[model samples]
Target: MVATKGGDRVSGMIVETEAYRGPEDRASHAYGGRRTRRTETMYGIGGTAYVYFVYGMYYQFNVVTAVPEVPHAVLIRALQPVEGVELMRACRPGRPDVSLANGPGKLCTALAIDRSLDRADLLGDRVWIERGDRPVSAASIARGSRIGIAYAGEWARKPWRFWLKGNPFVSRRDGMPRHVRAGRKAGGGA
Candidate 1:
């Protein structure tokens, strides 16, 4: 519930999210309401974490938002992890104490988020994006293929992904190296 210069937690948590429509939204794991116990949270409003397990190892994080009951959300591909950082680290221990809140998987890991958080409101204190006043420009935002799932075909190519032009804590994809890549490589649906 602590708000920061970059809007509170979830505000920035949701600062950049990809809107994956129904099943047609090829990139959406919940496309077609593929309710499989893991994606059930996608059906709710914007404010909760839509967490799911992948590769039997990593945990992908998302923010559930939109009209209640309407399945939609913005995938939280990455984060700055300003709030509750020690707690975040408790959830994700690194090989050398590196940030565990940068990548989509790391975000969830750092936050200790899993499917159990599904349907939990973002407006609540346990988890939420505390929106900021400033607006991140679309021009400053970059577009590129979402990470790890290039095999999604056209879904893989759709550049619904987004992020601040340059923030050291944000995640990096194959298209761009964290420090050397020019411009930003957009991400996929939230």
Candidate 2:
């Protein structure tokens, strides 16, 4: 149930995600005492959207959840490209199919997600997670802190990683060896 890029309707599946608790969660951008016009979205009711531009080149998507003002969000790490392969690839070319949705910015590019859809209701026709029968085993999943933000300090060590257990599509940062990244995907039978 992956969302379509061309205003075509499709459901978005929750494949791989990472949770960042506000304030207490150091890995979160809305960490304690940090607030901005951009972060203002993070302060709003959970279930809202937190889309932002990065590198002036790509958009990173995040889903706000938990109590309003709690500032918790699950970074959509990756999507399996289950429903729309051709569409995803058209938006994101030059990579293996698996790599299409492997990273945050990459996922948006592949999924055709952008700032225009920011704050849009995910439960609506344009986007949503249709129930699926994917057998994501616990053994196939993995856990670890998130990537690209060493500034998180102690929060950097939190094991908030969730992936499709043993799924090879999870994006790994550069320079990190394979054996060191063993992760267990969670919540089987989505």
**Each candidate: what lDDT?**
0.61, 0.71
Per-residue lDDT of candidate 2, residues 31-55 (tens digit): 8847887777777776666788889
Model 2: CA > 4 A from native? 7-13, 135-139, 173-190
- TM-score of predicted model 2? 0.82
Top candidate by lDDT: 2
- TM-score of each predicted structure versus truth: 0.71, 0.82
Model 1 agreement with the true structure over 1-190: per-residue lDDT tens digits: 2322223242224323455665667677766668766666777666766777887888766666677667777677766655556555556665223355667667666666666666666676566565545666667676666665565678777877776666555576434734554465656324
lDDT of 2: 0.71
